[model samples]
Target: MLSDKSRPIIQATLPAVGAHIEEIAKCFYGLLFAAHPELMDGLFNRSHQADATQQQALAGSVAAFATALVNSPDRLPENLLSRIAHKHTSLGIQPEQYQIVHDHLMSAIAEVLGDAVTPDVAAAWDEVYWLMAYTLTHVERGLYGARGVSPQTVWRQWEVEKKIQETDDVVTFVVKRIEDHLVKPSLPGQYISVQVPLPDGTRQSRQYSLSRADQGDSRQFSVKRVHGAAGKPDGEASTLLHTNVSVGDVLTLSVPFGPLVLDDYSGRSMVFISAGIGITPMAGMLSHLATTGSALPIMLLHADHNENAFALRDQIRDDIVALRHASIYVWYEQGADSKLPVQGVFAGKMDLSHVRLPDNAVYHMCGPVPFMHSIRSALIALGIPPRDIQYEMFGPDLWQADYE
Candidate 1:
């Protein structure tokens, strides 16, 4: 909770801070990287920095946290905190790093605000920063404890046993520990961070969802080649993995860490919706259901440009066929192949109007922000509770603040 003395000060200056938050974030990163250059090598996503998404996310989070503190001091924003904590834990963010961030961030605040930053105003915002930092540090500690690993010890080396082309753009890597060791088990729908060395000698990291059920000693994850559009540069990590990484290559991987896991589906129906490469986690859950011989009613829906663009389509079909009570639905914007014998596939955008949605079913969706937004709104209109609909995002979560 914010101290009562700081509450009124924050309320008075929030508008000015919010209006200039982006500038502060930009300045913070500049100062931080100048002092700690190693952070860019492996800890931070270079792509996000280049596009300013990381800065925007940071700015928005600080402003939102401050707003919530002033408006409802009695309540904590779990949604915001949970999202951040999960991402931080996945990256192995240590508690001490928060102080480094604080130093640079506070300096940036002072630099941007100039004479407006009185000691009282500075102290109030300082209190706000520590409150958020301490809360996140506590949450991250719990996450590390649950995973039974210390923050700095979460990384392991894995050798790529095989690289299978799932589609023209997507490739799946079957990996196992370099030495004969037991791989840590992961829940269905969890993800692992893969760090690869770039040509420039800096290591870049990206997270990919585990695309299959845990296999005790090996795991599978897919990477889609990211082709830059609209004058942007191609994703460095994806490009390097797609073109240079091959079977027998070693890569650094983090322990599986993600919050979207299917822990229970005993008596309730389930709806799984995904688009493009977002189908990875959904495939993991479906594989688990099949391996466990679950008899719960399940509906699998996916949207893609066409059949040729669908990753792991055959595997998903086989898993669905193995389940006792499961059905599959697909939507294609560019039309499915005419030679394919699949029936009841929709054409053009995804439309749920003609479909009968299962009653009292839990919904899990992963895809582009716009796609999830549209599906979520439609589901809500059809009487599904907001709490019942969960989603997984692949990159920096710029939409979560507004969506919530």
Candidate 2:
């Protein structure tokens, strides 16, 4: 809880700070990277920095946290904090790094606000920062403890046992721990961070959802080569993995860390919706359900550019077939071939009007923000409560600020 004295100050100055939060975030990253250049190597996403998405996410989160503190002092944003904590733990973010961020962030605030940042204002905002930081540190520590590893010790080396082409642009790597020990098991829908050494001798890291159920000693993750369009540069980590990584190669990977697991499916119906590369996690869950012989009614809905563009198509089909009670519906913008093997696939965008939505079903969705937004809106309109819908995103969560 915020002290009574600082609450009024934050409430009074929130408008000014909110208006300039983006500039402050930009300045903060600049100062931080300038002082700690090594952070770019494996900690931060270079593409997000280039496009300013990371800065916007940082600014929006701070503004949201401050607003919540002022308006709903008794409650915290558990969803937002959980998402952040999971991502941080996946990237091996340590507690001490929060202080570095705090110092630079405060400096940036002062520099951007100029004379308006009186000592009282500084102290008030400082309180807000520490409050947020402490909460995050607490959450991250619990995540690390659950995994039985410290932040710095969460990484391991895995050898690429095999690589399978899923689509023209997507490839799946089967990796095994190099030490021949039992790997820490992961739940369905969890993800692992893959760190690769780039050509310039700097290691870049990216997270990919575990594409299969936990099989004890090995894991599978798919990577879609991110080709630059409209003048942007190719993705550094993805391009490196696609062009250079091969079977028998060694790669650094973080322990599995994600909160989107399917913990219970006893009697409730389940709906899995995904688009593009977002199907990876859904596929993981499906594999688990099928392998475990779950009898729950499952509906798998997916969208893609075309039949040829669907990653893990055969795997998904096999998993669906393995289940006791399951159905699949697909939408393709380019239209699947008339002779295609799958049944009940549609052409054009998804239209749930004709589909039968199961009662008391839990919905899990992942995709581009726009796709998820449209599906979520439709689901809500169809009487599913917002709390029943869970989603995961590949990049910084810009959607939270927009939707909230």
Give the C-alpha lDDT of model 2. 0.89
In candidate 2, stretches whose alpha carbon ends up further than 4 angstroms from where it belongs are: 180-182, 336-343, 401-403
Summarize candidate 2's per-residue lDDT along 204-294 as a digit string, tens digits: 8899999998666788999999989899998989988988999999999999989788865458899999999999999999999988899
Clashing pairs in 2: none
CA lDDT of each prediction against the hidden true structure: 0.87, 0.89
In model 1, pairs of residues that clash are none
Total clashing residue pairs per candidate? 0, 0
Q: What is candidate 1's CA lDDT for residue 112?
A: 100
Alpha-carbon TM-score of each model against the true structure: 0.95, 0.97
Query: Highest lDDT among the candidates is held by which one?
Result: 2
**Candidate 1: minimum summed lDDT over ten consecutive residues — where?**
335-344
Error of 1 at 369 (Å): 0.8
Candidate 1 vs. true structure, TM-score: 0.95
lDDT of 2 at 305: 96
